[model samples]
Target: MQRVRVLVIDDSALVRKLLSTMLACDPAIEVVGVAADPLIAREKIKQLEPDVLTLDVEMPRMDGLTFLENLMRLRPMPVVMVSSLTQQGAEVTLRALELGAVDFFTKPSNDLASTFAAGAQEICAKVKLAALTRPRVRTIVRKLEVAPRLSADAVLPRAQTPDSRGGSRIIAIGASTGGTEAIRVVLEAMPPDAPPILITQHIPAAFSGPFAARMDNCSAMRVCEARDGQPIQHGHAYIAPGSQHLLAMWDGARYVCRLHDGPPVNRHKPSVDVLFRSVAATVGAPAIGALLTGMGDDGARGLAEMREGGAMTLVQDEASSVVWGMPGAAWKLGAASEMLPLDHIAARLLELARQPIARAMRAVT
Candidate 1:
């Protein structure tokens, strides 16, 4: 098997060694070199041209953010961040994800082994997936001027409703990088009565509240941050919180949101995988899944699992994706039942939702 080349960048000698050793333990991963900071890492990147980089969030002379911004802007490469596990760490990690890092890990706590043990499968899985992801292409994003299609007029806790249309179908949306705007375009086209939407978007902790607030104002659907114990209802939209993995549960008669801080699902908290898999298990053939543009294959396998469970699945086509990694990965694996352009996504979803669920929808059943 060909090894995935990785360069470890950190100021701490112990961390550099720890990550290198742990990552190298995977037969498929190779530590090309270790650098104390970005300055040295840059020179090594030029030399080794490694397949991936594991970066520490804090460093001397130049902080990780400055270095990461330059890395993505100048020579785009897949970067997995290693961050401290503090409140600030979570905040910075989210910023790193927005700035184009493929994924992240918390600086292992003192009970490092237990922490690693809890999330090793996740870390390794994400790193492997990151290796196959496409490099990011820089684009200038302009602020939106028009209102969203699904914004709610009044607050009803999580009871807020959009259009009264009922779908025999449910839709699961997974998006990251540039997802906000992409989702807006999709939601705007939908009728007030749309399918119950459960979205897992990669967002920073500080930004999620603001993001949900922004979405609620623009879109006709009642948008709110996912809360543990909250019930999922039609006409309501759930946005996964920044630091928690949002998983759906079949609570007897209704679906409820569950918050988790267990290992990073596909290198992300509130991972698309957790949401996709849960939906796959809950609704089975009655679900319509859409994997939008993002930085990696986080949702691919989970969506594939959903498809296996007889759910209709769509992946965003490349032309419209800011970074086509997530959708492309799903496409390459034949996981997507349909490949739809971003412009057509909302309508396509509505069309699919309007259709009656059939045993034909049960690919796995």
Candidate 2:
């Protein structure tokens, strides 16, 4: 088998070295070349002509975003943004994905080990998967001025909402790819006083903060990145940070979040599986498990586990999924008690919040 060839592009020599060496350790990946910035990378593209490019968010001579914009216009290839762990970094990484890069992984600044420890396998696998995709021709795609929203086909409205007359039940959401748009619909449908929501989106650590802020500004729900020891509350939403796993723990009657720098699950630091499993144990049947659009089978198995544990499970149907990987997997497992479109996820959860059976089961469990 031909090893997946990769081009490492960064302004920092140390980062170039670290990234190349780490990727090289994988038997299926080979470091084709390393460039200190986009200028060199542009030249390497013509010379080495690697299968994939690992792009840095910021670079000298030309930044990764501008270069990526040009790359997609001229010759499209799969690119993954390597981002710093900052709000600014988060914004750029999200922009890169919108601009045509594949999925991103966070690179911890203070500790090199943490960056490589969790995402090593995923990095290699993504590079290979990306290489197999049809490469785009160099044509100036008018940058989408606005992120695409899910069409009605993408969402199925389940029930009318505002279950603000609530109990302690909260919402747990997991999504990938088209999730940004899918989430927008669900959150928009939610009432301001809706139950507390916990979300795990497969995004880089650098991007979760801004992503949450973006959602907060757009939706009725107040969204923020989850912090350790933060008590689970009503009327607010917490998103799992990119570089850590967000799990829930029950202290007597109250639930607080615990953040751990553990090895990645399903090749993601803040894996949906980890969060769903934690909710299944902590909130039991009270929480609603929603599997949204995304690539791969990351959250499918875990959502299924949640359903078996007696949670009301909702899977977005294939018509609504951009990739149909995660939600489809859950459906195949027979986990989803209700299969709906992306638009309807919020209404269904609201109805669940109204059900005494949901909270009653949790209290007993």
Candidate 3:
């Protein structure tokens, strides 16, 4: 197998060296070159022609976002961002994902060397996955302009009715690679009355808050990072906090969000398996499970469990996935009752959300 060639770009020589050294530890990865800023990166890109790039969010002469935008337009390739563990860094990292970065890693707030050492495996793994990703060519950054907030009832007219209420209906979604934009597309297209959504996307703790905030700003549905004991509500979506696994549990009458600090499942802290299995056990047939674009099989068995538990299951078709590993695994297990394209998922979910529990179950399979 050909080793993946990577270019390291950071204003800090220490960061550049650290990144280069960390990536080189993997025999399958080669540090082809290093650049201090976007200007140098641009030139190195031409000369080295690397397979993947590790970029810094804040760099002298040219910021990472602008450089990524230009790179995607002129010479599209895989990129993984190295971001600071700050609010500002989180915002920029999300923007980089929107602009075409395959993924990002957050630098710890204290003890940089120790943190980097601990996260080296993750860094190398992401680089390998990014190398396999197909880069999309978007000439301009996708605008995430804020939209007017709509009440839950605005989309789901019967949402407030006692009979049409909470515990009986639920939606669980999971995604990883290229998930930031994929999730936004789904949420933006959903109706106001859509059932409460539970999401577990692979991301660091520092970025989850900003990711939720960005989702809230652009989506009609109220989006926020999940807190332990928060009740699930209609017209809102709860994203699993970074470093925690989010599970849905029934408290006699209604379902509520629960956070767990269990060891990483499938090598992901907020593993999709944990969330899906919890929903299968709690919500049963009334639940709808959708596995979007991701790079591993974390959610496959859990999604299959959801299906066996009588839930309607959907998997994003390979044609639309950034990396079809997770969804493909589920589909192979006969976990998904429906295989749909990305654009159709939101509308299908809304249609299912409006149906009576019995009818929703009958409509699938």
Candidate 4:
């Protein structure tokens, strides 16, 4: 079997050595070369033609982001960013994802050896995952003119009525590898009065806050990170905090979001399975579950439960997925009510939202 060749780029000698050592420990990974800066890394890329590149965010000569932008435009290849955990680091790392980075690893601040020791398996796994994903060309994002944010309660149709104690409608979404872009594509197409959305996109704690902010800037809906015990309001999309499981619970009057600090389910904190199951158990038939481009089966079983409970389930087709692992698994289990390409998902969701509660209830029965 051919090993995945990797090029390590970091300004810190210690970081380069530590990363090289961690990657080398995995027999399937081969350290082709290491560069102290992007200038040196640029030449190494031409020479070695590594399968993956581990890049640092802040680097000498040229910053990683600028280099990455050029690389994606000139020669698109899978690149995993090794970023610091500071506020600035988080912001830039999110931009790297926007610029077509396959994934990222947060640099440990203290006790580097011990931290990397704990995360060695994760690092190698991400590298392997990156190797399998197709590299996308970085495109120039046209800036949208700033507009006033609208409240959902003001414009969206109310799910509640005096005649019935009907539950609120929600859309639950989950993704992992290549999820940032996937989530962005779905959210960007959402109308102003779209259903309340809850998302669990596998990410580290430091990056989640910035990611929510970025999503808010790109989408029409009010996007924010989920907080413990927060009310699940209409016209707002909530992203699960990176290190916690987001659960939907009823508080007598309305459905609210709750964060759980339990052991990782399916080896993922804020696991897609955790979120999907909560929506299935609490929201039931009023929910819509979407399993998009990702690398694992974290959401397949939970999505099946959602389908059994009469909720609509959609999976992105393999042709449009970066890895096709999660949605493919869900499709194989007969969990998906509809399987569509990424471009059509948002429109399908809006169409589902148009169905009257009476009709949706009938379908559930």
C-alpha lDDT values of all predictions = 0.78, 0.77, 0.87, 0.88
Which regions of candidate 2 deviate over 4 angstroms? 1-8, 11-51, 69-77, 85-91, 98-100, 105-122, 132-168, 175-191, 201-211, 228-234, 241-271, 281-286, 293-301, 316-328, 338-365
Q: With candidate 4 superimposed using the best TM-score fit, by how many Å does residue 251's alpha carbon deviate from the native? A: 1.4
Which tens-of-lDDT digit does each residue in 1-365 have in candidate 1? Answer: 88899999999897777777778788888889999989999999999999989888789889999999999889998888888767677667766765777777777658765666666666666677678766554333333233335444454445654332221467889998667656666765555467678888987675677667666766667888889989877667888888988877766656777788887888888799899998888778788889998887889999999888888899999987767989999999988989987788877787777676655354454
Clashing pairs in 4: none
Instruction: Identify the candidate with maximal lDDT.
Output: 4
lDDT of 3 by residue, 130-177 (tens): 999888653222333434566667777763436423237799999988
Model 4 scores what on Cα lDDT?
Answer: 0.88
TM-scores vs. true structure, each candidate: 0.62, 0.63, 0.88, 0.90
| List of clashing residue pairs for candidate 3 | 155-192, 155-193, 156-193
Off by over 4 Å in 4: 138-167
- Per-residue lDDT tens digits for candidate 2, residues 180-261, read 6566667766766677888898876667788888778867668889999998776688989979988877766577788889
Q: Could you tell which candidate, 1 or 2, scores higher by lDDT?
A: 1
Candidate 4 minimal-lDDT segment of 10 residues: 138-147
Candidate achieving higher TM-score, 3 or 4: 4
The stretch of ten residues in a row with the least summed lDDT in candidate 3 is: 138-147
Output the TM-score of candidate 3. Answer: 0.88
lDDT of 4 at 295: 88
